[model samples]
Target: MFTSPFQDYVIDAAQRTVLFWDVMRARGNQYVEHTAQDAPHVLSYDFEPVMAGTDLPSPVNYGLVRIEPPKGVKVDEAKRPFVIIDPRAGHGPGIGGFKADSEIGVAMNAGHPCYFVGFLPDPVPGQTIEDIMKAEVAFIEKVAELHPDASGKPTIVGNCQAGWAAMMLASYRPDLCGPIIVAGSPLSYWAGVHGKNPMRYTGGLLGGTWLTALTGDLGAGKFDGAWLVSNFEGMNPANTHWSKKYNVYKNVDTESERFLGFEKWWSGHILLNAEEMQWIVDNLFVGNRLPTAEVETTDGVRLDFRNIRSPIICFCSHGDDITPPQQALGWILDLYADVQDIRACGQTIVYAVHPSVGHLGIFVSGGVAKKEHREFASNIDLIDCLPPGLYEAVLTEKTEDTPDADLVATDYIARFETRTLEDIRALGTNSEEDERRFATAARVSDVNKGLYQTFAQPWVKTLITEEQADLMMKIHPARLEYTMFSDKNPVMGVVKSMAKIVRSNRKPVERDNPFLVAQEQMSDMIIRSLDNYRDMRDNAIEALFLSIYANPLLQATVGLSADEKPPRARPGRSPEHIELVKRKVEDLKARISHGGVREACIRAMIYIGQPDSAADERRFEFIRSLRKGVPGELEAFKLTVREQFFMLLIDESAAIAALPDLLKGHADEIEQGIAFVRQVASTGGEPSDAVKERLSEIEKVFNTALCTKR
Candidate 1:
């Protein structure tokens, strides 16, 4: 007998309801189990502890562990190791290596040793950021000790919040780090477009960060990370309030495992010392000091980002609402007035913007892991060899039309294309008015914080005992949401049994059922309504913030003038820096004609490849294939490449003209060298007219050198 649509709907709905409740119960049970296990991280790979932060002089919850490569994976100890630091913003660490397709996986697959720097659920008493930095340096030193034969220092990757920490570490000890990659990190705090980036307005709407201070005080000197997670959820109301639950309700059987897996990490909220949290807010979020070299250590050393000597790679995404392209790339604009400033600092900065990935997806998404991360890991050497300047990392999938396809090692072709400050500005930034408003907000925050500390903090701290703080954390909505649905709840026992019975006799409605279609339409309507509400709320907040902080009277009260320049306006180059640049330029000029066959070959490749304004793996790989032996140690070769690149940059004409002199004694090698460069020049495709012209110039130089030798 065929049932009516109503009957089908009733039966299917009943089963789904039971299954949804069961999934929630399972999630609760998993949370309990996870906590019982002391919330072991979600890293898919097994690991052995290398060093514990607690063992250091200034103890911390952080630890460094070495990952054991999975079956069939071989690690080369001689290759530079990879040390990944996952963000400890709210959740526990291991997001960077929680699955097979992750940062750790990519490095291991590439035959590099991998280490993870993660933290425990709680901080050591009075532990500070400086202590963590010390631990990080020690961990790196240990890695270096372990890999004495490695060709280069470890490549450090910082995901999300760890991005800033890694940058600080690199700036603090540039000699200890190799390439530094920061994924989904916001270095420039006040950078965002009006109307679109509402998160930047949040602090202003809240009247600044005094609330953060109050929360830390109320928590009895320990900040509960659940509050941070709650703030993140508030950014997307539809997802937090309805869609995530509805997804599981709609596809309970298939989604439960993935949901449980993610919840293992998402629900693992850690703690931070009140001092640590307060320092982060006052120095970074509100003070906005890190980018401009205003942040200093307790010992008084300035943490200037320009001091970082290694290649810095920024990976962000357009679709990421949290760390948008503006916030990720804006610091470049803040620190350097022009590309020459970057080159003067001897810095190589590369950035990659994903077209549509979300913030977390930049680090955790499998597709990104396979493509972007993989390409980055493989082409790191190319990045290291690049000259000091700004470049964009572009990855394109290989195709049959690709030239010299056989020489390509990976499935994608990686290119580093030159970029300029205009490109970063084009991503969108705050106007002058917006800057004034943010500055006003900062000033207001300072006043409010002072008031609270003087008036409210003492009383709150005195009244809020450890027991009360513990109770408050237990009853927090974020934690309660999981606890209330667990097997410990008497009502869940009934739902659990019902779920088993329903699973045994499942009755799923067909997709075309009128009731099912109606259900989907209702869901869409609900989602739209919530999204509209979110948009309205954000707009109102933005408007309110501007009205309160952007007023001329209020700006004046905050000591901001109508003619105040944007916060990111950089001062002119220092006299000392200018002298240094001049000296470096002169030094490079003197070495224009001081290289052998290897230098000539690298310079020729760089010169010919200059027309495309890009460097590709195919060309680099072809060069490697032709070399019967390495010219020297990898470090020496890197120095040679950098020297030649700078020589070309400082005086391309002189550098190319002098190449014939350097190749004079190697007349017999001239034909082979030219052939090698020509083949590499054509690796990506048929050489463009400009590339062909450069190649002809190289040929003429080589021929002249040969004739001169005769």
Candidate 2:
């Protein structure tokens, strides 16, 4: 093939320039963490050594930093102590509290005492997850002891892997956890969108747990965590290859430091015990037994998620392909038959799903950290104040034009509605077919693990030594940047000197620069190319696996082996308990007939959704007008209504069966309530649609029961 002289010259120049750039970046990555890490004095970070009863338990260290809260945000004396646990999947600690308005910063600004859960770089000779759990409990207990006068319990904020870890701790050690908030944690691991969320199918496609064991063996008994973090990044080829790098290249003047900074942490992954990785994959990914009370600790202690007493708040986003809302909330469907089951378990689980925020947004986004995280920290008590049931989490943005929150130029109040088990299942739309596949994957993993250990174990143990293994962990392409760029290399000094020169000029592209605009467009184009390459690679792998696995006979067998089935209500339970429950339901039903919550809710819905042409456009005026005598009374009313509602749910099997007959008398009242809701809404359209839907569902249930009983 003949090439033009101009084209040949261009290709040669580009190759040389790319090679030089790689050399410089390889050196700069040693100390920077964010892609845009320009040194600013606004934040200071330190990972003070964690005191283990013995030598460093793991290669990880933990520490706390004092954040100087910016002006105007008040610190509340009565707030509970805040402890933020950043995910140690691939990155280093401190991102949870990386900025001044971060989770740690928000907690501190709110005047609550705060703590951080951190780790060292190396694990003890044989550190296990069980040991890590013991250390975290000890740390939290010490914080509680330090703050004897703090109101309520300590609020534990867990980000990503830390989020699931916190949930495990809360389930087993509820006394130690105050209120648990899991940000971007995927509990219902087996569930997700097939096309969009292909990551979860990894174990099945790889022929189960053999790869994990092989990788562990390859790493000489200690599994490299960089591999796992890479899997996370690999899930988003677009983000990892194109967007992330293009973001830095286009905004090179501002993004250079940030890119290096984030890469530093992302590349600085620690290792996990072979047992730890195996268990997480078997019990979490393939088996998905955690939420359904199937996980057992190493010591035979079963981990029952239902044991947790704290009001659980789940923060996830639709844009988070890694941990979609379906994956976050689907556990509810796996665990319970209905909303009543949640209440009966005495659990309050509230979930918030963002319209477009990504998984990391749950933790790293400044807007999220300031608003949702802040509101959660501030009103945790209010959430606890809610009756024992499921609810949605919402956050309303403050606007500039309106003195009142109604007129505030807010995008939308950030509020998440409490969802039902049915509501959760509705998101993923998974049927028995999907559940069976995960079950088969779990069984296959078991068989492969047993076979591998029997045939490959002796050889694997003797073939690789510690030194060879350690080098492999550091040099794994996933961590190539971190291992090569440290200051220990004399070559880094040259790169540092160049960086200093770049920092001196400190010129970013002007908002109006045409060249800058073109550069950004080009960067985006490169990013898209990378993303498409990734998409093609993933599709190819999936297609290959599908062709191998798609046998009607084999799939049927797998389905038969799946553990999912219908739930059974207990037989012949105590009559005394049943009788007492019946009476409470009756009393609560009467209370609701005269109360303000349903009425207030319906009216509020109408006023907000339907704008009235003739009337003043305010949602709470009707409720506010009724607020004169309710000043101290709103709390009293809320408590009374909440208590009665839950009480009815707790004791009303008989009432539930007879609901239609019961609703016969309240039919007029229910309609009146609906009509009142319609009047309060704006005139353009139906305002109280959700509330109406709720009422309609209730009516249908009653109508069905009435038909059968009569």
Per-candidate TM-scores read: 0.97, 0.74
Off by over 4 Å in 2: 1-74, 298-300, 400-418, 485-522, 541-642, 648-710
Q: What digit string (tens of lDDT, one per residue) describes model 1 on residues 240-356?
A: 999989999998868988888888899988899988888888878877778888888888877889989999999999999899999898889878988978988989999999999
lDDT of each: 0.87, 0.63
User: Lowest summed-lDDT stretch of 10 residues in model 1?
Assistant: 624-633
RMSD of each: 1.6, 9.1
Model 2 / residue 644 / CA error / Å: 3.4
Measured with C-alpha atoms, the lDDT of residue 698 in candidate 1 is: 92
**Residue lDDT tens for model 2, 1-710:** 86654544444334433434544455344533432332211133333433442433443234333333456655554557888887767566677877776788767765776677765544555666666766677677776776666666688888888887888878768877777899999888877765667777788878888888888888887788888888888877777766776555444544556665455565556667777777778777776777777667777876777778788888999899788888888777766668776776667888877888987778878888777787777566556545567778756555554334443222433333545676676677455556555666666677778888899977988898889998887567776654465555677676656556555644343445554456567777877787778778777765654554445466555444223352211122246745765786667656443433353343234223322212221333344345444334444544553554453444444323334443454544554544544444532224356545544554456445345545
Q: Which stretches of candidate 1 lie over 4 Å from their true place?
A: 567-574, 627-632
